[model samples]
Target: MKLVKHWIEKIFATITEGIVGALDVFFSSLQKWFGVGSMPYIFVLPNLLIFGVFILFPMLLNFVYAFTGGTDFFPNRRPWVGTANFTRLFECQNFLVPNSCSEDLFWRAVFNTAGYVVAQVTVMVAMSLITALILNRSIKGQAFFRSVFFYPVMLSPIVVALIWKWILQENGLLNAIILSLGFDKMPFLVDANWARFWVVIISVWALMGFYTLILLAGLQSIPADLYEAAKIDGANAWQSFSKITLPLLMPTMLVVLVLSLIRAVQVFDIVFAFTGGGPGTATLYMVQYIYNNGFASPTKQYGLSASSSLVMAGALIVLTMIQLYVRREDV
Candidate 1:
């Protein structure tokens, strides 16, 4: 028995030593290939080139252009005027009459953009999570229901916007339905407030399905054993959800929130299609303002528009960093 025990101990020590030696060699080889002395640039060259051409160059050009006062894209004879574009942006009066007491349209657009982001992000995240939770449960024809929920996401945003535009028009189907139901017609896209509200609603409707599908995948990844164990401990459904589900599902929730916030900040298409920043600039978003100034009608202010775009991009980066910090703390 002593001889057998000595042999067993020797075998275990040999295996452990072999594993440690093998791991050390593997790490050493990896360090040689990826360490400070290695040519890491060779591996990252393609990505660097792509980012430089697509992102960095454009960003540098925008920063330079923002300090100029060029109305034309080519800027035939325009000269640089440091901070003049920004000052003009702040000092410009309203295009509309009577309310033209030198209010900054750019700042107003920023406020409108902020409000829209807050409203849309809140609605989209909440609605998507609720829909995902509902679909995660066992139900009849779940596949069909899932398909129905995700169908909107598959459609192009422009197509969705056009459909919603007709539906929310003055004499549109929504009003017709209301009239049929013996109620007065609601001005969904006519009045400024109604137009803004409808934009948020339509945005939520269009995006909820996509986010729900993503959240559903997260839900499906959670272990059923955790819920079963909770149930065995005499926990109710709500208790199981709060204890086993939310904590585990938090990472997925954070991802969805970050993505939703970024998308909301950069939203443009739906605003363009639904309400062309009309009803006296009630629904004018930052992107739409940038588009109008940089490319669209009336007075072309490409330099100022570039400045606004830079500001918006900087704000998004800050917000994203804050969100990541909060998520890290929670984790």
Candidate 2:
């Protein structure tokens, strides 16, 4: 024990010395070139440059493109149209009634996305919470079950979608079973409502494990003594869960909710692979519409696509802001 402690101490001391030497050399060079007061800015300059290059520059270009009409990819060739794209997008007799808009498909995408997020997030969070609670209990094959649930999380989204697509196709395994039961083959992806339903279900199934793992982490962190004390006071499972679990789990729940909503809003690959935004655009979510407009459209309305992207970006910003507020409040 004494030898192990001595080795650990020596290791930490060496690390500390190395950090101190590096910092000293760095500051000396900075002081020689500039001054101590400029150290903070100098240190942040590289990160700022990287951020500007990778994030800020792309965002600025997207924003600029939103104001320019274009079939051409080059900004130099794209004609400046000011806010004409926005004006066209917003030209509606009534904002609430999406059909009144010039870009009715865009508005339909927005509405579909909103509904999808609400339903998907609600089911996803609830199922994850339930799964986490069940998993938190002592059980045989617990680790095995956890691995099984989380296996889907490791698979690529497209792969998952394709696998599900095969199962849900007209002449797939599911229909094979249905036929064996003397029932008709179902058009799971061909029908609009069915496509939307399957999209949400598949999304939840693919993602449940990730959120379950998160909730499980939160569940495990709660001191066992709290549950013990509650038990001594004759608290039943419902009482214990509602009072102890929910309250303590609130922060994690909020995080899961926000993340689920963001992911739900941004859902694309699965819907694309599984349904292809078909059955008369019933399952067309905003991101899919953005892709269709930005790339697949006959004219390829880049400005309109950029404008749609900005709307999605705005939703993302609001979600991020909400997350920040919730975390701060929790703190």
lDDT of 2 at 257: 94
Writing each residue's lDDT as its tens digit, candidate 2 over 199-253 gives 8999999999999999999999999999999999999999998999999999999
- Stretches of candidate 2 above 4 Å error? 1-50, 329-331
lDDT accuracy of residue 75 in candidate 2: 88
Give Cα distance to truth, residue 208, candidate 1, Å: 1.1
Best by TM-score: 2
TM-score of 2: 0.84
Leading candidate by lDDT: 2
Give the clash count for each candidate. Answer: 0, 0
Give model 1's TM-score versus the native structure: 0.79
TM-score of each: 0.79, 0.84
